[model samples]
Target: MGCAISGLAAKAEFGERNTGDDAAAPAAAAYLREDQIQMIKESWKVIRDDIAKVGIIMFVRLFETHPECKDVFFLFRDVEDLERLRSSRELRAHGLRVMSFIEKSVARLDQLERLDALALELGKSHYHYNAPPKYYSVRT
Candidate 1:
Protein backbone atom coordinates (compact mmCIF):
# COMPACT_ATOMS: atom_id res chain seq x y z
CA MET A 1 0.00 0.00 0.00
CA GLY A 2 2.80 2.40 0.86
CA CYS A 3 4.64 1.75 -2.37
CA ALA A 4 1.45 2.05 -4.38
CA ILE A 5 0.57 5.46 -2.88
CA SER A 6 4.08 6.77 -3.39
CA GLY A 7 4.04 5.55 -6.94
CA LEU A 8 0.72 7.23 -7.62
CA ALA A 9 1.85 10.50 -6.07
CA ALA A 10 4.99 10.42 -8.16
CA LYS A 11 3.04 9.96 -11.38
CA ALA A 12 0.17 12.31 -10.63
CA GLU A 13 0.41 15.42 -12.77
CA PHE A 14 -0.66 18.53 -10.93
CA GLY A 15 -1.36 20.47 -14.13
CA GLU A 16 0.05 23.99 -13.80
CA ARG A 17 0.56 25.97 -16.97
CA ASN A 18 3.01 28.71 -17.90
CA THR A 19 2.39 31.59 -20.27
CA GLY A 20 5.90 31.24 -21.78
CA ASP A 21 6.99 34.74 -20.84
CA ASP A 22 9.88 33.50 -18.66
CA ALA A 23 12.84 31.28 -19.44
CA ALA A 24 12.39 29.25 -16.24
CA ALA A 25 8.80 28.46 -17.20
CA PRO A 26 9.76 25.23 -18.91
CA ALA A 27 11.45 23.89 -15.80
CA ALA A 28 8.52 24.87 -13.63
CA ALA A 29 6.12 23.07 -15.96
CA ALA A 30 7.52 19.68 -15.04
CA TYR A 31 5.77 19.38 -11.67
CA LEU A 32 2.96 21.84 -12.23
CA ARG A 33 -0.44 20.58 -13.26
CA GLU A 34 -3.35 23.00 -13.67
CA ASP A 35 -6.46 20.82 -13.72
CA GLN A 36 -6.38 17.83 -11.34
CA ILE A 37 -4.45 19.91 -8.83
CA GLN A 38 -7.61 21.44 -7.45
CA MET A 39 -8.53 18.27 -5.57
CA ILE A 40 -5.17 18.19 -3.82
CA LYS A 41 -5.23 21.94 -3.17
CA GLU A 42 -8.76 21.97 -1.75
CA SER A 43 -8.20 18.86 0.32
CA TRP A 44 -5.05 20.32 1.83
CA LYS A 45 -6.78 23.61 2.60
CA VAL A 46 -9.56 21.79 4.46
CA ILE A 47 -7.16 19.54 6.32
CA ARG A 48 -4.89 22.43 7.30
CA ASP A 49 -7.78 24.53 8.62
CA ASP A 50 -9.24 21.59 10.52
CA ILE A 51 -5.89 20.72 12.05
CA ALA A 52 -5.26 24.32 13.07
CA LYS A 53 -8.60 24.52 14.85
CA VAL A 54 -8.12 21.20 16.59
CA GLY A 55 -4.53 22.03 17.56
CA ILE A 56 -5.58 25.32 19.19
CA ILE A 57 -8.39 23.64 21.10
CA MET A 58 -6.11 20.83 22.21
CA PHE A 59 -3.38 23.23 23.30
CA VAL A 60 -5.81 25.08 25.54
CA ARG A 61 -7.30 21.88 26.91
CA LEU A 62 -3.86 20.41 27.50
CA PHE A 63 -2.66 23.47 29.39
CA GLU A 64 -5.81 23.38 31.47
CA THR A 65 -5.49 19.69 32.26
CA HIS A 66 -1.75 19.67 32.88
CA PRO A 67 -0.74 23.05 34.07
CA GLU A 68 2.68 21.67 34.89
CA CYS A 69 3.53 21.51 31.19
CA LYS A 70 3.18 25.27 30.95
CA ASP A 71 6.50 25.58 32.75
CA VAL A 72 8.21 23.63 29.98
CA PHE A 73 7.09 26.19 27.39
CA PHE A 74 7.86 29.09 29.71
CA LEU A 75 11.40 27.86 30.22
CA PHE A 76 12.25 28.67 26.60
CA ARG A 77 10.50 32.02 26.59
CA ASP A 78 12.15 35.41 26.68
CA VAL A 79 9.93 38.40 27.39
CA GLU A 80 9.96 39.48 23.74
CA ASP A 81 9.51 35.98 22.37
CA LEU A 82 6.67 35.29 24.76
CA GLU A 83 4.95 38.54 23.83
CA ARG A 84 5.36 37.79 20.12
CA LEU A 85 3.87 34.35 20.40
CA ARG A 86 0.98 35.73 22.40
CA SER A 87 -0.13 37.97 19.55
CA SER A 88 -3.09 36.76 17.48
CA ARG A 89 -1.27 37.04 14.14
CA GLU A 90 1.85 35.31 15.36
CA LEU A 91 -0.16 32.59 17.06
CA ARG A 92 -2.14 31.96 13.90
CA ALA A 93 1.02 31.82 11.81
CA HIS A 94 2.54 29.35 14.25
CA GLY A 95 -0.63 27.28 14.15
CA LEU A 96 -0.62 27.28 10.34
CA ARG A 97 3.01 26.19 10.21
CA VAL A 98 2.29 23.29 12.54
CA MET A 99 -0.91 22.48 10.67
CA SER A 100 0.92 22.35 7.33
CA PHE A 101 3.34 19.78 8.64
CA ILE A 102 0.48 17.74 10.08
CA GLU A 103 -1.47 17.98 6.83
CA LYS A 104 1.51 16.67 4.88
CA SER A 105 1.84 13.79 7.34
CA VAL A 106 -1.82 12.92 6.94
CA ALA A 107 -1.50 13.06 3.15
CA ARG A 108 1.33 10.57 3.39
CA LEU A 109 -0.41 8.28 5.87
CA ASP A 110 0.83 5.18 4.11
CA GLN A 111 4.43 6.08 5.02
CA LEU A 112 6.06 6.13 8.46
CA GLU A 113 8.70 8.78 7.66
CA ARG A 114 6.89 11.71 9.22
CA LEU A 115 5.74 9.67 12.21
CA ASP A 116 9.29 8.56 12.93
CA ALA A 117 10.59 12.12 12.67
CA LEU A 118 7.88 13.36 15.00
CA ALA A 119 8.65 10.65 17.55
CA LEU A 120 12.35 11.39 17.38
CA GLU A 121 11.79 15.09 17.95
CA LEU A 122 9.47 14.38 20.87
CA GLY A 123 11.99 12.05 22.43
CA LYS A 124 14.77 14.60 22.10
CA SER A 125 12.58 17.33 23.58
CA HIS A 126 11.52 15.04 26.41
CA TYR A 127 15.16 14.45 27.28
CA HIS A 128 15.63 18.20 27.78
CA TYR A 129 12.97 18.13 30.48
CA ASN A 130 14.41 14.99 32.04
CA ALA A 131 11.16 13.27 31.30
CA PRO A 132 11.11 9.51 31.19
CA PRO A 133 9.02 7.83 28.50
CA LYS A 134 7.19 6.02 31.27
CA TYR A 135 5.71 9.36 32.38
CA TYR A 136 3.33 9.17 29.43
CA SER A 137 1.94 5.89 30.68
CA VAL A 138 1.54 7.36 34.12
CA ARG A 139 -0.40 10.31 32.73
CA THR A 140 -2.69 8.10 30.72
Candidate 2:
Protein backbone atom coordinates (compact mmCIF):
# COMPACT_ATOMS: atom_id res chain seq x y z
CA MET A 1 0.00 0.00 0.00
CA GLY A 2 1.21 3.46 -0.87
CA CYS A 3 1.02 6.43 1.50
CA ALA A 4 -2.57 6.95 2.60
CA ILE A 5 -1.85 10.64 3.01
CA SER A 6 -1.92 13.07 0.13
CA GLY A 7 0.80 15.70 -0.25
CA LEU A 8 -1.63 18.38 0.76
CA ALA A 9 -2.70 16.53 3.85
CA ALA A 10 0.87 15.84 4.97
CA LYS A 11 1.82 19.47 4.46
CA ALA A 12 -1.12 20.60 6.47
CA GLU A 13 -0.30 18.35 9.39
CA PHE A 14 3.52 18.51 9.28
CA GLY A 15 4.12 22.01 8.10
CA GLU A 16 6.56 23.00 10.81
CA ARG A 17 9.63 21.97 8.82
CA ASN A 18 10.41 22.63 5.17
CA THR A 19 12.14 19.69 3.55
CA GLY A 20 12.18 20.81 -0.05
CA ASP A 21 15.77 22.07 -0.03
CA ASP A 22 19.26 21.35 1.28
CA ALA A 23 19.15 24.18 3.72
CA ALA A 24 19.16 23.59 7.49
CA ALA A 25 15.90 23.22 9.33
CA PRO A 26 14.61 26.69 10.08
CA ALA A 27 15.06 27.74 13.70
CA ALA A 28 17.37 24.86 14.41
CA ALA A 29 18.41 26.30 17.78
CA ALA A 30 14.91 26.54 19.13
CA TYR A 31 13.54 23.57 17.25
CA LEU A 32 12.45 21.47 20.19
CA ARG A 33 9.69 23.14 22.11
CA GLU A 34 9.51 22.90 25.90
CA ASP A 35 6.72 20.39 25.80
CA GLN A 36 8.49 18.41 23.11
CA ILE A 37 11.68 18.23 25.17
CA GLN A 38 9.79 16.88 28.15
CA MET A 39 8.07 14.34 25.96
CA ILE A 40 11.28 13.29 24.21
CA LYS A 41 13.11 12.79 27.49
CA GLU A 42 10.22 10.92 29.03
CA SER A 43 9.79 8.63 26.03
CA TRP A 44 13.50 8.10 25.45
CA LYS A 45 13.97 7.22 29.10
CA VAL A 46 11.48 4.39 28.69
CA ILE A 47 12.63 3.16 25.28
CA ARG A 48 16.35 3.91 25.44
CA ASP A 49 17.36 0.30 25.71
CA ASP A 50 15.13 -0.63 22.80
CA ILE A 51 16.17 2.11 20.38
CA ALA A 52 17.11 -0.52 17.85
CA LYS A 53 13.59 -1.79 18.01
CA VAL A 54 12.33 1.76 17.73
CA GLY A 55 14.29 2.22 14.55
CA ILE A 56 13.05 -1.06 13.16
CA ILE A 57 9.47 -0.22 13.99
CA MET A 58 9.87 3.22 12.44
CA PHE A 59 11.14 1.87 9.13
CA VAL A 60 8.69 -0.98 9.11
CA ARG A 61 5.79 1.34 9.65
CA LEU A 62 7.18 3.71 7.05
CA PHE A 63 7.27 1.02 4.44
CA GLU A 64 3.95 -0.47 5.46
CA THR A 65 2.20 2.86 5.38
CA HIS A 66 4.08 4.18 2.36
CA PRO A 67 5.18 1.14 0.43
CA GLU A 68 6.82 3.21 -2.24
CA CYS A 69 9.46 4.25 0.30
CA LYS A 70 10.90 0.78 -0.07
CA ASP A 71 12.03 1.80 -3.51
CA VAL A 72 14.47 4.23 -1.91
CA PHE A 73 16.44 1.36 -0.42
CA PHE A 74 18.21 -0.81 -2.99
CA LEU A 75 18.61 -3.51 -0.36
CA PHE A 76 14.97 -3.41 0.63
CA ARG A 77 13.51 -3.02 -2.84
CA ASP A 78 12.26 -6.58 -3.15
CA VAL A 79 11.17 -6.98 0.46
CA GLU A 80 7.70 -6.03 1.62
CA ASP A 81 7.25 -8.25 4.64
CA LEU A 82 7.96 -6.39 7.87
CA GLU A 83 9.27 -9.32 9.91
CA ARG A 84 11.73 -10.34 7.24
CA LEU A 85 12.63 -6.77 6.62
CA ARG A 86 13.38 -6.16 10.28
CA SER A 87 15.59 -9.21 10.32
CA SER A 88 17.84 -7.94 7.55
CA ARG A 89 21.28 -6.98 8.81
CA GLU A 90 21.37 -3.77 6.85
CA LEU A 91 17.98 -2.75 8.20
CA ARG A 92 18.94 -3.56 11.75
CA ALA A 93 22.26 -1.75 11.61
CA HIS A 94 20.97 1.36 9.90
CA GLY A 95 17.95 1.47 12.17
CA LEU A 96 20.08 1.27 15.29
CA ARG A 97 22.48 3.93 14.05
CA VAL A 98 19.62 6.28 13.25
CA MET A 99 18.07 5.79 16.63
CA SER A 100 21.43 6.46 18.20
CA PHE A 101 21.67 9.71 16.33
CA ILE A 102 18.17 10.59 17.48
CA GLU A 103 19.20 9.90 21.04
CA LYS A 104 22.09 12.28 20.62
CA SER A 105 19.80 14.87 19.16
CA VAL A 106 17.67 14.70 22.25
CA ALA A 107 20.59 14.60 24.64
CA ARG A 108 22.31 17.60 23.06
CA LEU A 109 19.20 19.64 22.57
CA ASP A 110 20.79 22.48 24.52
CA GLN A 111 23.96 22.33 22.44
CA LEU A 112 22.96 23.45 18.98
CA GLU A 113 26.29 22.90 17.21
CA ARG A 114 26.50 19.26 18.14
CA LEU A 115 23.06 18.69 16.73
CA ASP A 116 23.90 20.89 13.74
CA ALA A 117 26.99 18.86 12.94
CA LEU A 118 24.99 15.67 13.18
CA ALA A 119 22.36 17.05 10.86
CA LEU A 120 24.98 18.02 8.33
CA GLU A 121 26.51 14.58 8.49
CA LEU A 122 23.10 12.99 8.13
CA GLY A 123 22.26 15.28 5.21
CA LYS A 124 25.36 14.13 3.40
CA SER A 125 24.36 10.55 4.04
CA HIS A 126 20.81 11.18 2.88
CA TYR A 127 22.06 12.83 -0.30
CA HIS A 128 23.99 9.69 -1.07
CA TYR A 129 20.73 7.76 -0.64
CA ASN A 130 18.83 10.10 -2.95
CA ALA A 131 16.43 10.79 -0.13
CA PRO A 132 15.86 14.45 0.45
CA PRO A 133 13.96 15.47 3.53
CA LYS A 134 10.75 15.98 1.59
CA TYR A 135 10.46 12.22 1.17
CA TYR A 136 10.21 11.79 4.95
CA SER A 137 8.04 14.78 5.85
CA VAL A 138 9.22 14.52 9.46
CA ARG A 139 7.59 11.36 10.88
CA THR A 140 9.09 12.28 14.28
Candidate 3:
Protein backbone atom coordinates (compact mmCIF):
# COMPACT_ATOMS: atom_id res chain seq x y z
CA MET A 1 0.00 0.00 0.00
CA GLY A 2 3.00 2.26 0.46
CA CYS A 3 3.80 3.31 -3.10
CA ALA A 4 3.85 -0.19 -4.51
CA ILE A 5 3.65 -0.09 -8.28
CA SER A 6 2.94 -3.43 -9.97
CA GLY A 7 2.24 -2.68 -13.61
CA LEU A 8 4.09 -1.81 -16.81
CA ALA A 9 2.61 1.64 -16.89
CA ALA A 10 3.87 4.17 -14.35
CA LYS A 11 1.22 6.00 -12.37
CA ALA A 12 2.02 9.21 -10.56
CA GLU A 13 -0.40 11.80 -9.29
CA PHE A 14 0.74 15.29 -10.02
CA GLY A 15 -2.64 16.85 -9.74
CA GLU A 16 -4.85 16.60 -12.86
CA ARG A 17 -3.49 16.03 -16.31
CA ASN A 18 -5.46 16.93 -19.50
CA THR A 19 -6.33 20.11 -17.61
CA GLY A 20 -5.30 22.35 -20.48
CA ASP A 21 -1.71 22.54 -19.33
CA ASP A 22 -0.40 21.98 -22.84
CA ALA A 23 1.98 24.90 -22.66
CA ALA A 24 3.53 23.56 -19.44
CA ALA A 25 4.26 20.14 -20.89
CA PRO A 26 7.87 19.65 -21.81
CA ALA A 27 8.82 18.47 -25.28
CA ALA A 28 10.33 15.02 -25.56
CA ALA A 29 13.60 14.72 -27.41
CA ALA A 30 15.32 11.75 -29.00
CA TYR A 31 18.80 13.27 -29.02
CA LEU A 32 21.05 12.89 -26.01
CA ARG A 33 23.86 15.28 -25.21
CA GLU A 34 27.03 14.26 -27.08
CA ASP A 35 29.16 14.48 -23.96
CA GLN A 36 26.79 12.35 -21.95
CA ILE A 37 26.59 9.77 -24.71
CA GLN A 38 30.33 9.66 -25.07
CA MET A 39 30.74 9.30 -21.32
CA ILE A 40 28.32 6.39 -21.23
CA LYS A 41 30.04 4.74 -24.19
CA GLU A 42 33.43 5.09 -22.61
CA SER A 43 32.24 3.87 -19.22
CA TRP A 44 30.43 0.91 -20.68
CA LYS A 45 33.52 -0.24 -22.55
CA VAL A 46 35.25 -1.01 -19.27
CA ILE A 47 32.53 -3.33 -17.94
CA ARG A 48 30.81 -4.67 -21.05
CA ASP A 49 32.91 -7.84 -21.26
CA ASP A 50 32.26 -8.76 -17.64
CA ILE A 51 28.54 -8.21 -17.74
CA ALA A 52 27.91 -11.70 -16.41
CA LYS A 53 29.97 -10.95 -13.35
CA VAL A 54 28.11 -7.69 -13.07
CA GLY A 55 24.82 -9.50 -13.31
CA ILE A 56 25.82 -11.97 -10.63
CA ILE A 57 26.82 -9.20 -8.28
CA MET A 58 23.66 -7.30 -9.03
CA PHE A 59 21.45 -10.29 -8.20
CA VAL A 60 23.43 -11.02 -5.10
CA ARG A 61 23.04 -7.46 -3.97
CA LEU A 62 19.36 -7.48 -4.75
CA PHE A 63 18.86 -10.60 -2.66
CA GLU A 64 20.92 -9.07 0.08
CA THR A 65 18.82 -5.96 0.05
CA HIS A 66 15.60 -7.94 0.01
CA PRO A 67 15.94 -11.65 0.72
CA GLU A 68 12.38 -12.16 -0.44
CA CYS A 69 13.44 -11.46 -4.00
CA LYS A 70 15.16 -14.83 -4.19
CA ASP A 71 11.73 -16.41 -4.07
CA VAL A 72 11.10 -15.11 -7.55
CA PHE A 73 13.61 -17.55 -9.02
CA PHE A 74 12.38 -21.12 -8.74
CA LEU A 75 15.90 -22.46 -8.88
CA PHE A 76 16.91 -20.27 -5.97
CA ARG A 77 13.56 -20.35 -4.32
CA ASP A 78 14.56 -22.95 -1.78
CA VAL A 79 18.26 -22.40 -1.81
CA GLU A 80 19.56 -22.78 1.69
CA ASP A 81 23.08 -21.71 0.92
CA LEU A 82 23.67 -18.30 -0.59
CA GLU A 83 27.13 -19.28 -1.71
CA ARG A 84 25.81 -22.33 -3.47
CA LEU A 85 23.29 -20.21 -5.28
CA ARG A 86 26.02 -17.82 -6.28
CA SER A 87 28.06 -20.64 -7.80
CA SER A 88 25.09 -22.32 -9.46
CA ARG A 89 25.73 -23.08 -13.12
CA GLU A 90 22.08 -22.63 -13.97
CA LEU A 91 22.00 -19.29 -12.25
CA ARG A 92 25.19 -18.30 -14.06
CA ALA A 93 23.76 -19.17 -17.44
CA HIS A 94 20.53 -17.32 -16.81
CA GLY A 95 22.27 -14.29 -15.33
CA LEU A 96 24.77 -14.14 -18.16
CA ARG A 97 22.11 -14.45 -20.84
CA VAL A 98 20.01 -11.74 -19.23
CA MET A 99 23.02 -9.51 -18.90
CA SER A 100 23.94 -10.09 -22.52
CA PHE A 101 20.53 -8.92 -23.59
CA ILE A 102 20.87 -5.87 -21.39
CA GLU A 103 24.25 -5.09 -22.90
CA LYS A 104 22.76 -5.55 -26.33
CA SER A 105 19.94 -3.22 -25.39
CA VAL A 106 22.42 -0.55 -24.34
CA ALA A 107 24.49 -1.02 -27.48
CA ARG A 108 21.39 -0.74 -29.62
CA LEU A 109 19.66 2.06 -27.73
CA ASP A 110 19.57 4.10 -30.88
CA GLN A 111 17.42 1.47 -32.55
CA LEU A 112 13.89 1.90 -31.26
CA GLU A 113 12.66 -1.31 -32.91
CA ARG A 114 15.40 -3.37 -31.32
CA LEU A 115 14.66 -1.87 -27.91
CA ASP A 116 10.96 -2.58 -28.35
CA ALA A 117 11.66 -6.18 -29.28
CA LEU A 118 13.90 -6.64 -26.27
CA ALA A 119 11.22 -5.14 -24.02
CA LEU A 120 8.61 -7.48 -25.49
CA GLU A 121 10.85 -10.44 -24.79
CA LEU A 122 11.39 -9.24 -21.24
CA GLY A 123 7.66 -8.79 -20.76
CA LYS A 124 7.06 -12.40 -21.74
CA SER A 125 9.79 -13.62 -19.43
CA HIS A 126 8.35 -11.52 -16.64
CA TYR A 127 5.00 -13.17 -17.20
CA HIS A 128 6.60 -16.57 -16.67
CA TYR A 129 8.53 -15.34 -13.68
CA ASN A 130 5.49 -13.60 -12.27
CA ALA A 131 7.61 -10.52 -11.85
CA PRO A 132 5.64 -7.39 -11.34
CA PRO A 133 6.66 -4.24 -13.16
CA LYS A 134 7.84 -2.83 -9.85
CA TYR A 135 10.17 -5.78 -9.48
CA TYR A 136 11.87 -4.76 -12.69
CA SER A 137 12.21 -1.25 -11.35
CA VAL A 138 14.18 -2.57 -8.34
CA ARG A 139 12.77 0.24 -6.24
CA THR A 140 10.05 -1.77 -4.61
Candidate 4:
Protein backbone atom coordinates (compact mmCIF):
# COMPACT_ATOMS: atom_id res chain seq x y z
CA MET A 1 0.00 0.00 0.00
CA GLY A 2 1.02 3.66 -0.27
CA CYS A 3 2.42 4.95 2.96
CA ALA A 4 1.58 2.11 5.40
CA ILE A 5 0.01 4.13 8.16
CA SER A 6 -0.65 7.65 6.93
CA GLY A 7 -0.44 9.43 10.25
CA LEU A 8 1.72 6.89 12.05
CA ALA A 9 5.01 8.33 10.85
CA ALA A 10 7.44 9.40 13.56
CA LYS A 11 7.74 13.08 12.75
CA ALA A 12 9.52 13.50 9.40
CA GLU A 13 11.51 10.36 10.07
CA PHE A 14 9.36 8.65 7.51
CA GLY A 15 10.34 8.99 3.84
CA GLU A 16 8.16 11.98 3.01
CA ARG A 17 6.58 14.73 5.05
CA ASN A 18 2.91 15.17 4.51
CA THR A 19 1.78 18.54 3.19
CA GLY A 20 -0.87 20.53 5.00
CA ASP A 21 -3.56 19.05 2.78
CA ASP A 22 -2.30 15.58 3.50
CA ALA A 23 -2.34 15.95 7.24
CA ALA A 24 -5.67 14.26 7.68
CA ALA A 25 -5.11 12.36 10.92
CA PRO A 26 -4.22 13.88 14.23
CA ALA A 27 -1.05 12.83 15.97
CA ALA A 28 -3.24 12.62 19.06
CA ALA A 29 -3.76 8.97 18.26
CA ALA A 30 -0.31 8.43 19.65
CA TYR A 31 -1.54 9.71 23.01
CA LEU A 32 -4.79 7.82 23.13
CA ARG A 33 -5.79 6.74 26.64
CA GLU A 34 -6.27 3.10 27.55
CA ASP A 35 -10.04 3.45 27.51
CA GLN A 36 -9.89 5.09 24.08
CA ILE A 37 -7.65 2.35 22.86
CA GLN A 38 -10.06 -0.23 24.13
CA MET A 39 -12.90 1.56 22.41
CA ILE A 40 -11.00 1.53 19.13
CA LYS A 41 -10.24 -2.17 19.49
CA GLU A 42 -13.88 -2.88 20.15
CA SER A 43 -14.95 -0.76 17.16
CA TRP A 44 -12.47 -2.57 14.97
CA LYS A 45 -14.07 -5.88 15.78
CA VAL A 46 -17.07 -4.98 13.66
CA ILE A 47 -14.91 -3.87 10.76
CA ARG A 48 -12.38 -6.70 10.94
CA ASP A 49 -14.66 -9.13 9.18
CA ASP A 50 -14.92 -6.97 6.06
CA ILE A 51 -11.31 -5.91 5.96
CA ALA A 52 -10.82 -6.92 2.35
CA LYS A 53 -13.98 -5.24 1.21
CA VAL A 54 -13.07 -2.12 3.19
CA GLY A 55 -9.67 -2.17 1.57
CA ILE A 56 -11.15 -2.35 -1.90
CA ILE A 57 -13.61 0.40 -1.22
CA MET A 58 -10.91 2.59 0.29
CA PHE A 59 -8.74 2.30 -2.83
CA VAL A 60 -11.62 2.75 -5.21
CA ARG A 61 -12.53 5.95 -3.45
CA LEU A 62 -8.93 7.04 -3.40
CA PHE A 63 -8.58 6.48 -7.12
CA GLU A 64 -11.85 8.17 -7.77
CA THR A 65 -10.79 11.31 -5.94
CA HIS A 66 -7.17 11.14 -6.97
CA PRO A 67 -6.89 9.38 -10.30
CA GLU A 68 -3.24 10.30 -10.61
CA CYS A 69 -2.58 8.13 -7.58
CA LYS A 70 -2.99 5.11 -9.87
CA ASP A 71 0.42 5.84 -11.37
CA VAL A 72 1.90 4.59 -8.14
CA PHE A 73 0.57 1.09 -8.85
CA PHE A 74 1.98 -0.46 -12.01
CA LEU A 75 -1.01 -2.74 -12.42
CA PHE A 76 -3.46 0.14 -12.52
CA ARG A 77 -1.46 2.83 -14.26
CA ASP A 78 -2.66 2.08 -17.77
CA VAL A 79 -6.15 0.93 -17.03
CA GLU A 80 -8.77 3.40 -18.27
CA ASP A 81 -11.76 1.78 -16.70
CA LEU A 82 -12.21 2.26 -12.98
CA GLU A 83 -15.24 -0.01 -12.59
CA ARG A 84 -13.39 -3.01 -13.98
CA LEU A 85 -10.87 -2.66 -11.18
CA ARG A 86 -13.51 -3.71 -8.72
CA SER A 87 -13.14 -7.34 -9.84
CA SER A 88 -9.46 -7.22 -10.69
CA ARG A 89 -7.59 -10.06 -9.12
CA GLU A 90 -4.55 -7.88 -8.81
CA LEU A 91 -6.50 -5.11 -7.16
CA ARG A 92 -8.17 -7.58 -4.85
CA ALA A 93 -4.81 -9.06 -3.94
CA HIS A 94 -3.31 -5.65 -3.29
CA GLY A 95 -6.38 -4.67 -1.36
CA LEU A 96 -5.96 -7.71 0.83
CA ARG A 97 -2.34 -6.82 1.41
CA VAL A 98 -3.28 -3.29 2.43
CA MET A 99 -5.99 -4.56 4.72
CA SER A 100 -3.63 -7.09 6.24
CA PHE A 101 -1.27 -4.25 7.12
CA ILE A 102 -4.11 -2.35 8.75
CA GLU A 103 -5.09 -5.45 10.71
CA LYS A 104 -1.56 -5.87 11.94
CA SER A 105 -1.27 -2.18 12.71
CA VAL A 106 -4.41 -2.24 14.79
CA ALA A 107 -3.17 -5.33 16.60
CA ARG A 108 -0.02 -3.45 17.55
CA LEU A 109 -1.64 -0.24 18.77
CA ASP A 110 -1.06 -1.25 22.38
CA GLN A 111 2.58 -1.59 21.47
CA LEU A 112 3.23 1.93 20.22
CA GLU A 113 6.88 1.44 19.53
CA ARG A 114 6.24 -1.67 17.50
CA LEU A 115 3.42 0.05 15.67
CA ASP A 116 5.59 3.06 14.90
CA ALA A 117 8.41 0.84 13.72
CA LEU A 118 6.04 -1.09 11.49
CA ALA A 119 4.74 2.12 9.97
CA LEU A 120 8.28 3.40 9.63
CA GLU A 121 9.37 0.38 7.63
CA LEU A 122 6.34 0.54 5.42
CA GLY A 123 6.82 4.28 4.86
CA LYS A 124 10.45 3.69 3.93
CA SER A 125 9.36 0.99 1.50
CA HIS A 126 7.07 3.50 -0.18
CA TYR A 127 10.11 5.29 -1.54
CA HIS A 128 11.14 2.16 -3.43
CA TYR A 129 7.71 2.02 -5.09
CA ASN A 130 7.43 5.79 -5.66
CA ALA A 131 4.36 5.96 -3.48
CA PRO A 132 4.21 9.26 -1.64
CA PRO A 133 2.55 10.09 1.66
CA LYS A 134 0.32 12.44 -0.30
CA TYR A 135 -1.69 9.55 -1.65
CA TYR A 136 -1.97 7.95 1.75
CA SER A 137 -4.60 10.42 2.88
CA VAL A 138 -7.26 11.48 0.41
CA ARG A 139 -10.39 13.54 0.85
CA THR A 140 -13.55 11.50 0.62
**Top candidate by lDDT:** 4
For model 4, residues 1-68, the per-residue Cα lDDT tens digits are 23333444533443444455444443333545567678888888888889888888888888999898
List, residue by residue over 6-66, the lDDT tens digit for candidate 2.
2334434544454664233332434455676677788888878888888899989889998
- Candidate 3: deviation at residue 111, Å? 1.9
Return the clash pairs for model 1, or none: 14-33, 15-33, 15-34, 16-32, 16-33, 16-34
Q: List runs of model 4 lying over 4 Å from the truth.
A: 1-28, 133-140
List lDDT for all candidates, in order.
Answer: 0.47, 0.70, 0.61, 0.71
Model 3: residues >4 Å from true position, as ranges?
1-31, 133-140
What ranking of all candidate models by lDDT puts the best one first? 4, 2, 3, 1
What lDDT score is found at residue 41 in candidate 3? 67
Candidate 1, residue 88: lDDT: 42
| lDDT by residue (tens digit), candidate 1, 21-101 | 433232211333443344565677765657766555554555567655545454322323333344445445556666666
Error of 3 at 57 (Å): 1.1
**TM-scores, all models, native as reference:** 0.39, 0.69, 0.67, 0.72
Go through the candidates in order and give the C-alpha RMSD of each one to the true structure.
14.2, 7.0, 7.0, 8.0
Identify the superior model by TM-score, candidate 1 or candidate 2.
Answer: 2
- What candidate 2 gets wrong by more than 4 Å, as runs, is 1-36, 132-140
Model 4 earns a TM-score of: 0.72
Error of 2 at 73 (Å): 0.6
Kindly report which residue pairs in candidate 3 clash with one another.
Answer: none
**What is the TM-score (0 to 1) of candidate 3?**
0.67
